[model samples]
Target chain A: MGPQHPSTHGVLRVILKLDGEWIVEAHPDIGYLHRSFEKMGELRTYTNGLPLTDRWDYLCAMTNNLVYSMAVEQLLEVEVPERAQYLRVIVCELNRIASHLVFIGTYGLDLGAQTPFLYCFRDRERILHIFEEICGARLTYSYIYPGGVSGDALPGWLEKVDAFLDYLPPMMREIDQLLTGNEIFILRTRNIGLISPEQAIDWSLSGPMLRASNVNFDLRKESPYQVYDRLDFSVAVAEQGDCLARYHVRVAEIGESIKMVKQCLAQIPDGPTRAKLPKTIKPPAGEVYARVDTPRGELGVYMISDGTDKPYRQKIRGPAFVNLSILSELLPGWKIADAVSILGSIDVVMGEVDR
Target chain B: MSEEEKLENTETSDKPLKPAGKASPGKALAEVTPPDPRLLALAELLQSTFGDAALESVVDRGMVTLVISPGTLLDTCQQLKTDPALSFDYLACLTSIDRQDHLEVAYNLRSLTHKHEFCLKVRLPRDTPEIPTVTSIWKGANWHEREAYDLMGIHFQGHPDLRRILLPDEWEGHPLRKYYVYEPDDVPSEQGPPEHLLIQLEGVE
Candidate 1:
């Protein structure tokens, strides 16, 4: 149905066998955007590979950077400074908010609601502006690095973030009013793409997809990393595993991210952001699998070091890639129109899917 | 169960409540913390059950890694998933690494109920790397195994629809192999417009 269709969201092609209006079978044909990032990573040094991760999931590049950096840090056994840990948490959560905002906006547009898209982008612009102030790039900020973040927060940068957090809740309410409670949005999404909890777990779904199925698994809560344990928050979950429930889970998570960021700002201590290390980064010969709870799901980085500056192997377990695999299993019985809603709920970015 | 009865029951029990390998009483508490009892128990359980099938087990970086023989990969995975003491239901990640001489596939597994995780590894000869698919045990392994097969040229014996996942089917060599060489000329470049397109342009003119 697409490598180009707007509803498919980023260059995913699905071959479907249809019976009148109902779909008999669906096979997702991905890999149109494969850049072989793993092969490229093996050719570069540990420090040089940070920027390549920015391309994996461009929506939340901060989390991608943080996860890769965590894996390298585990191998190097370097302890990040307290302030840098707080900064990592703040930026990762903010990126989560920005990524979810994109999901909500595009999801509304996919379901035939245009006003919410404009509202979501308006609020998302402020988050991008803050990111630009911190890292000088909006979409692909390689701000988080191994051992620590790239730089410390500027003099008034914390204040700027606080101001944006203050401005976000009201705008989120407006989006909720415009789309979440809309009758047409509910009618299109409520029971359209239902996934049982067992199916969600067996398929290894994560983030909002698994949470919508009532699986209370979040890496931040389960296995805290980067000052997440200090911050108090709740995982957003929904009992019904459907398109509408997934939407609700993401919307609720934006609020939780807001709470976590505010706490980071309040408890942030005055200290150095980057750690002191040798000029060359050559981790000891070993293997480690480090994972972080990204906005989409669990972004795991499995790194193998052979006592060289470059990695022996690096494998990225992208959540969108795994979440999208359930398409063929989920799309068989639904109608063609519902297929759009179901695919949109999965919210896959083809860059990660095909990488 | 009253609180006193619970305390009395614990006190009357024959087995001491102290952890299995307690340090000398003269040693300072901060000097050496003992190994985690849960991890020790898990290691014991795995060692007792798998025995010879489990080649080597090591605890490194706060994670348990069990190297299983290729012949016992599928059966070991089934038991890991179904065994109540070790319910590694979720296949977190599957990765294949090229070691220049031999190929290795690592499976990262986690049990949501127990909140414990481990790594399972299997070594195969580089030329003919093949292992039974674990998708029958955990459905999520379907794409992960396919990815390992696609990028590293590992063959799954009984995958339902094993094909190149992140690479096109016609693509030749697995790019993640240590010996793989990239040839720029291998990529097909676009020739000029097709004959049908040229004829259509002429008709329009």
Candidate 2:
């Protein structure tokens, strides 16, 4: 429905075979915004590719940068400073909240609730303000470099972010009370787009979508990377794999991110924000992979370098691309109105899907 | 000290007893569940199940990667997914790499039950790259195989709907290969990319 429509998020075109209100088959024809980011990554130097990562998933650019930088760091065997790792976790968790807030707001819009949309965006604006203060840019913040973040957190930035952590829960509760208990929202979402746990695993669904179906596999909890091992948080899971269950998973995650942010604020040590990097940063001849738990799912980068400034090949295993692939399976036999709820529940950003 | 005493004291973890050359030296991965040291055990288990079907295996950066014969790719993956001890139900990521000498397809599989992972790779000839599709085992390989076919031009023999995914249907060349040269379409291709994509490709040699 949308290579141009608002609900599909970005330039994603889905071809639906339907009989009057019943969807027969649906295929998402993506790649309308294909920038050839991997080809560009192959052409650019190791560190020059950071900004390009920012463009793939604009909603969670920090996680993109974190994944790519960890890939290069694994190849080069350079250690990131303790403070930079802490900062990476902080910014990534903040972007997770911002990205999920967008999902809640837009999913509310899809289900025909306009007031919750305003509430979600009102909270998201504050997160963007904190990002703007840390880096100069808001939407595409290329603040995270290969070795470390571009700069240290400003003197008052941590406290402001801590205040934000406290500020979001009550509003999130407002969102929950307004949307979660709404009878119509339940009528639209419950049992409408159900994906079984076996189906979710075999179909390679991840993040909240997989967890919603009672799978206990989170990359943060299972394969903890970058200071995630130090932080303690529970993986939010739901037994029913429905559109409403997806909402419940993200809502629970917002609270967990707040707890993790509080821990980082109290324990973050004072030190240099970046590590020592060589002038011409060329990783040795080998391949390394690194993955992180982004707001969407596992955002992984597989890079092979042949002792040169440029990468031999860089493949971004984007979570949105794989997560969106299962729409055809979940969309059959549902009414056309349920299509919006189903697709929006997947929360795909076409930027990453197309890339 | 007795010989039995020395053998018992070594270590009971899943780590390989042979001390194979897979993980790079001196890189200790202590985070998260102490980085499972049982890489060699997984390799031996696979070898025990399928004798010569498992070709050569290596460890790079603490990841246990096994290179399987192209002919046995389907059977190896089928067993890896269904086996009770090694049920790798999750297909995390799949893509092909062009090594200029030959083409290699990589499959990263993980077991939610066992909490272990395996990297299965198959090398096909550069000229005619074809392998059996694992879609019948895990449906996630459907789009991944299509992407590999679209960008890298690796043919999945049994993939039900093998179509170009990221690029348009009428595009000329597979652009991911090192020596891939794009021949312009007579009618400015179906969703033609913008002019800014032009590259000299001059100094790439």
Candidate 3:
């Protein structure tokens, strides 16, 4: 049994009570990285808080931006320009692909396979480059504004993005060959972390986790937002509700996001990317909730405004937070090695989890 | 696909429950239920069951907000989940707001069976911010409630293993609260090792 260790990601100190190399009980001691990001939002002006949202889910900054912006927009009763909506769709889908790539790479590394990790990051770099082109920075691009995007897409950037999209399929094929069909990979993942559909629903699991359990509930499909209503895609679901099933769902989702991006690029119209927002943004006295399907799950934002520049209260509904709730239920009775695999299957980023 | 099978699915598995007293006498006898009217029925049922406990307020541009009290939180959630007419089986999200004056808890509940959603809120005072845990009903509420407690200093009673989730155990102050002060300390820096330091002539000079 491992003692409480610091480098296990986040401040997650787990005392694993093991018997003969098998985990008997895993007691997780968290709260090492807890920043009250929710309470902080209530203190800052609506615009100032967008950057903080970027920090929460650093991997999928676009989704966080969209969720928070949507909430603020709801409070202010402002409609973003259609062009801005299209831009959001494109960036979000790109972010989804990047996040899925990290998921694939990290899951491989967790299971003692290193080659796929490198291969996945090779693709991730290209996505990061595209993001850098859109916004000057790379890691936490706080580009999505409340009324619209920060600025217009750079000159000839669309052509470069098209080139990237064109080459993504062959790279994805290489990833599949390297990990998906390998016998060892299948054995490690197939039935390792089994949770039933009912269990998933009861736990409020969303995104790939819930889809892996065969509940076809994608917010993109069930509650279409932005340009999702017009996009053609499928909510990838599987009945296994195991590690392998979760992996497959995420893989399939990568393909669907690629498809959505293609359609968005093709149908993107020429118009002003932002609306005429007021200088000092003050929303009416009311509450609003907005949800966007992040790579992890449904990233929701709820804001209460008391007719002021700052919010009365802002609550960020992080998908990782809810998804991690089921970990205690899943870890016991499984081998310690399987615990890492299951954690990977849930696809938690401590930034969002600990936020 | 048989008539009997279709009838059974509609009667037992699909349809939402009928609200007592609210259902008209003539319609109550007829019992003609529509497909997946659970969310609609739930709104009506909640209004009648816990009259003032279920407070509906529009936030922003007509976005529905239903304020629920702490005491009836568990029963309200269970009814939304188990009742076929109002099966809000999926707790999409659970989060909290730290008002220096008061702590606000929000639950985003969705019906996977019916494809509908609604928000539930409960406010607790800052001096004694405590609310019942809904982990018994949704299980997803466990981490969320802990997060609230961790960040906003709200206590979630009956949480199986309630402790600091996002912040360190030894770490002082909740960073999320408005009144949390960020005061820097006056500790002096440790001196560098003498062997590694640059030479300076003092007594010899």
Candidate 4:
């Protein structure tokens, strides 16, 4: 119903074929913001393509940046310094918290709870400020470079992050009380949008959506990368596979991410944040696939290089694009009010979906 | 003569030679695991079953890739999903590449139960690019196949609804193709999409 609906989140339209309150067939119309980033990547040097990734999934720029850069790193066969890996873990988890907060806030709005939105954004503001301090920009910080992060956290950033960590739990409790534990919210979401585990995998669902169906696969844990192999965290999972379960998985993940961030802060060593490299990134001729668990799902970069500074072809395996495609399958039996909830629960950023 | 000399002497020549530096412990840990044995066995199984359909099985840098005949894309996909040993229920990605000489459709597959992944590529001639759809096997392939059709103009033979998912319905050319040239002033060139004729093209139902 929106290239511009309040709950559609970004530029998307769904043409619903309906029988009164029930959906007969739901056809999602996307790609309104198609920038052809893949084609643009072909024209630019490998290093220049990093900035464009910031726009791919604006919510978790660090995660998106790291995924693309990791693909290039695999092709180049370069190693990220130990400290850089730690920095990546720190920033990515922080970004994950920020992204999940946005999801919870906007989702509350979608389900008709307004006060939780204010509480979420209020906490989310501290994250953006912290990000701005680290990378000089919020939202689309192109800080995660090919070899490593653009720069290390400023002098007192860790202490500031620690303070935020202490401040986060009570806020989490507040949001839970306001929305998660609210009777109305439970009535609307608990069993309304149930997806069986078979449907989850057969439709190739991932992240919270897949985990909600009780699939325990997480790329960070399953196929660990960077310093993730050393990190202590558990993948969040739920059995119901409802809108409530998706919400629960993400909320639980926020607590897990905070734990990982604290671990990085405690164990991070002082060292060079970037590796030595030539002015241009000219990876050898090869194709590599790398993926990271973004707040939404598996964000992968499939790149093919022709032993040149410019990539021959690049493909972004955007989780939002794939996750949103399941709408047609999931939406047919549900009522119209549930449409916004289901779509919001998928947690898509259209920038990635349309890219 | 020194500590370096003794270490160098111990380093085997067969090891693909670490590229010019000491790998960090993390980098060493990330050393590409050897190709999945399950996938390798699956390749042998496919080769033994469909000798002609299975064209090649390649293991590059620990990634298992299978090149199969395009005519058997649908059949191969079906077997990959249902076969209990290689229960590749998760279709990670399905995209077509315009590799100048030919169009190649690559299916990056994953199985949760088996915890393995496989890549299947089907090469198609540039002019008459057609491959049977795998929507019956994994419903997720619906949009992926539609996207391949939309961006690369690779027709999916039996996709339920293979309309242009991303591009405009009346868009002249598949912008992703290597040959697609964006001429701002000219709507159609001698070789470009027949823009004028495509106006009357209806959405494929």
Chain B TM-score per candidate, please.
0.70, 0.71, 0.65, 0.70
- Ranking of candidates on lDDT, top first: 1, 4, 2, 3
Q: Give candidate 4's error at residue B17 in angstroms.
A: 16
- B95-188: candidate 1 lDDT, tens digit per residue: 9999999999999999999988889999999889989998878888898888888999999999998999888899898889988877554353
Which candidate number would show the highest lDDT if scored against the true structure?
1
User: TM-score per candidate, in order?
Assistant: 0.90, 0.90, 0.85, 0.89
Alpha-carbon runs more than 4 Å astray in model 2: B1-36, B47-51, B182-205
Q: DockQ for all models, in order?
A: 0.21, 0.24, 0.24, 0.24
Q: Tell me model 3's lDDT, rounded to 2 decimals.
A: 0.77
Tens digits of lDDT, candidate 1, A265-312: 998877777776677999879898999999999999999999999999
lDDT of each: 0.86, 0.83, 0.77, 0.84
For model 4 chain A, the run of ten residues with the poorest summed lDDT? A73-82
- Name the regions of candidate 1 deviating beyond 4 angstroms: B1-41, B184-205
In model 4, which runs have C-alpha deviations exceeding 4 angstroms?
B1-28, B32-52, B184-205
lDDT of 4 by residue, B47-122 (tens): 6766777788775544567888887777778888888877889998886889999998888898888777768899
Candidates 1 and 3, the one with greater lDDT: 1
Give per-residue CA lDDT, model 3, range A1-355, as digits (tens): 2223322434455667778767777666555565667766776898898899988888999999998888876565555666787899999999999999999998888787899999999999999999999997777988998878999998898888788889999999999999999888899899998999999988888899999999999988776666676677888998999999999999999999889998888877777777666777897687767888999998888777888899877777888778877877788888877887887788877778767
Chain A TM-score for each of the predictions? 0.99, 0.98, 0.96, 0.99
lDDT of predicted model 2: 0.83
DockQ of 4: 0.24
Residue clash pairs of candidate 4: A2-A12
